[model samples]
Target: MRISPAYLKSGILVSTAGVFGSAFLWLLSFKAMAFWMGPEGVGLFSQLRQMAQAATVGATFGGTNSVVQGLAERKDEATRRQFRATAARLVCLSGFAVVLVIAAAAPLLTQFFLASSAPALVATVRWIALAVLLNVGGTYALAVLNGYRSYPYLALAQIAGPAALVMLLGGAGWWHLPPDPQLLSGAFVLCFGVTCLVGAFGVSRLPKLERALRLGALPKAQSRAFVRFAFSNLVAALSTTVALLLVRSWVIEAKGLAFAGLFDAGWTLTFNYTTLFLTACSAIYLPRLTAAVRPEDRRACMLKTAYLVLGAGILVCHAMVLLKEPLIHLLYSSQFQASGEVLMVLVIAVIFRGVSWVYGTLILATRNSRILVVSDVALNLMLLASTRYALDSFGSLQALSWAFVLPNFLYLVFVVEYACLQNRLMCRRDIWPFLLAGTSPLFYLALSGPQWANSGLVTGLSMVVGLGAAGAALLAYKKVVS
Candidate 1:
């Protein structure tokens, strides 16, 4: 059952291209939206998007992990069909329930997000709720695809959905549509609808992916287990969403709405690119981990994947940090110039988060729900406390960068240590190379306060170091596979 190096390499390349393609399109759509709406509008859109994402989590009732597990573990075709049928029924029912709840609470959502309950805004919230339903179905489809290791179809759905979204938004602008919440929300609906359709089509094309929907008897025990695992995922996800919401609100109250936009800008640049690597790696990595039975086998897979991610992440982090200002201008606009300062600090956090993500995948594969939930809660609480401390001490939006750095670094440490102890892996010794590569970017930034980004000597040295680390990582990965 060992995964082949050729398969892993090709799978990662295709997955990365697919993720990058979709991310690029989404970024373009955001850029267009930012140009039209400015910082405040961008911040509003971020918040609304966050709300829909949160609702999508609820709508799925946390079944994605369960679905993946059920589909991945079962050897019997009949059992797989029964599991798929039960999951589909649950997903549909839960999606309907969440939509109803959101429809009922539209006014409340408007007040919470917009600070006003105008008729138009409330209607916009309802529209976003419908988008959540589409997204929930899409999420289920993706989990099923993941269970089957259908990475090409996964990539197709990922790329095509966002491609449709970019086109829709581009067309709206060409038609000179108003840059309002309603229009933005409608674009979301279209995006999710297309993704859902593509995912469903992907499932249809794979005869092995077919579910026996007519199978009358539901597997209640398996359904409950899936739900229980999903609830754990839901709690972790909701904590993150709530923390971001609170952080944005506090930034608005302390500085202004525009300041919150700056926070969003920095946050986006730091995490979005990192997520691309993580998601692409997870596409192949998670299934392998799930199928791996021995501790040594799991450790080998985890180490190789971590090296691969860190190698790629180190290069990306340094490049973004060095080019933050110009990238901000190019990706966002001149109005977001100040966001570059925050981006510099946040990229450091990105390295830590990227390293931690490898270990987090281990946790997910092992299904240690308590550890997952507790660690997630701790991360968010630390985020809130650290950001509040930064605001109290520095009293500037730039200080919020500390909030991202400290929490992720600590979370990285926690996960690495726990992963070693829980699995009896050689993490302490083996982690040093990644730790050195991960922390190397912090020195210049800490000393010069983003001024180093402008220094040619610093940039050249960083590029050299980043390339060397990446090259070594790739060699190490090849060694592991061989």
Candidate 2:
């Protein structure tokens, strides 16, 4: 099916706005929090969030994403509504239970993460935990909207939480209150509560969802299939989280919380900016891929999405790598400026991850959580191993960054092989565009120092080249399509 101009434009604009808006607000909150709280507090804030999110992913039982995949292919509106509502109901029950567990564990986890648990830290953990529970409905709402291909509403709900949180933080800043982790956590919870309310309202307004409230019992077979898929996905999600928590633990043990904060800061910057493209891809591609049942159709969609995102990622990463130091300094204090080398290396990861998301979405759309688990577990193990060696030997985060790059390369190789062989998708003509786009930033970075990259003349030249290459990749993709 050809993408209509208005539909495509609306999708891009709204989805981009959604991602860009949320990123902006979150980034802004980071800046404000940093200024309000010192680096250590920021570190605590970030750590709490990571832990809370991991827990939420587990507690979700993978219902959020499975809702999308389950509903995507359902041509029956009533059935889709049932699936959506069922997931929402089940996740809410799980969320409440998870909140209780997190609340109980807050004291211990706080001490574990921070080396000493104070009342404030424990309180902060509780607040973030509550936020996670509070936001479950919103999470499922976005998933439902996505399943329906309601990009605009999905985008709206995506930003609603962050936007609300930003306003709260901004108001706090206006009042000149000191930004403690607990206070920031409260803002997170409160704003997210609002976000959940907004999402529920939005979903309530949808046509058939109201009918879901009227339905009594779901089809046993359908419910069984969705729950099974969601459970498998939950394992994958939780496993990745465990791996990440291990990595964070290692970083803190080796370097301390201050450095952990810096590491997270660097990592966060890379993903936040780069994920903008990935977000757009998900909004546009997942439903499309989900609706395509034929193997050829799925493969074709995967390659096209991969090439498009990878091509776009090249230009973005180039600009980001070139501007890394300045961008970090602009967003954060001088304390964060140490991560330039790491960010430079992470540029490659960004490009790789940009494409990986396409492949990942394809895998997810096909409901192959087993592949997702194996690939992810392997990469995480490699990451944990290499990162351990790098930290032990070189004692440098930059070395650790390269360690991540190694596993990710292997991960992408495995992913590409799987996507090609399993789906029988062949796009030899499209491969070069991704390779060229993915490699150009790395080539430039390896040859020049960060100072050279950041210089006015070099930055300008690189931007020009990047824009040209990205534009050409898009043109080439268009040609392939025709």
List of clashing residue pairs for candidate 1? 62-230
Show the lowest summed lDDT stretch of 10 residues, model 1.
Answer: 209-218
lDDT of 1 by residue, 254-332 (tens): 7766887877888887786677557666677777788778888888888888787778777877778767778889989
Let me know the TM-score candidate 2 reaches against the reference structure.
Answer: 0.91
| lDDT tens digits by residue: candidate 2, 1-482 | 24477987788688778878878877877776666664665566667666766777777875356777777777776777677667877887888888888888888877776666779878888878878887776677777776666777777777888887777776776788865677877887876687678767777777654433576446888788878788878877677677777777777766787787787777778865676547555766777888787877776677667667776777777877777777888877777887677787787777777766777776788788688677777777888899889888998878878877778777777777677667655644456455665576566764587567667787677677777777776766676541
Q: How many residue pairs clash in model 1?
A: 1
Q: Considering every candidate listed, which one attains the maximal lDDT? A: 1
Per-residue error for 222 in candidate 2, Å, reads 1.9
TM agreement with the true structure for every prediction = 0.92, 0.91
RMSD in order of candidates: 2.5, 2.8
lDDT for each candidate structure: 0.78, 0.73
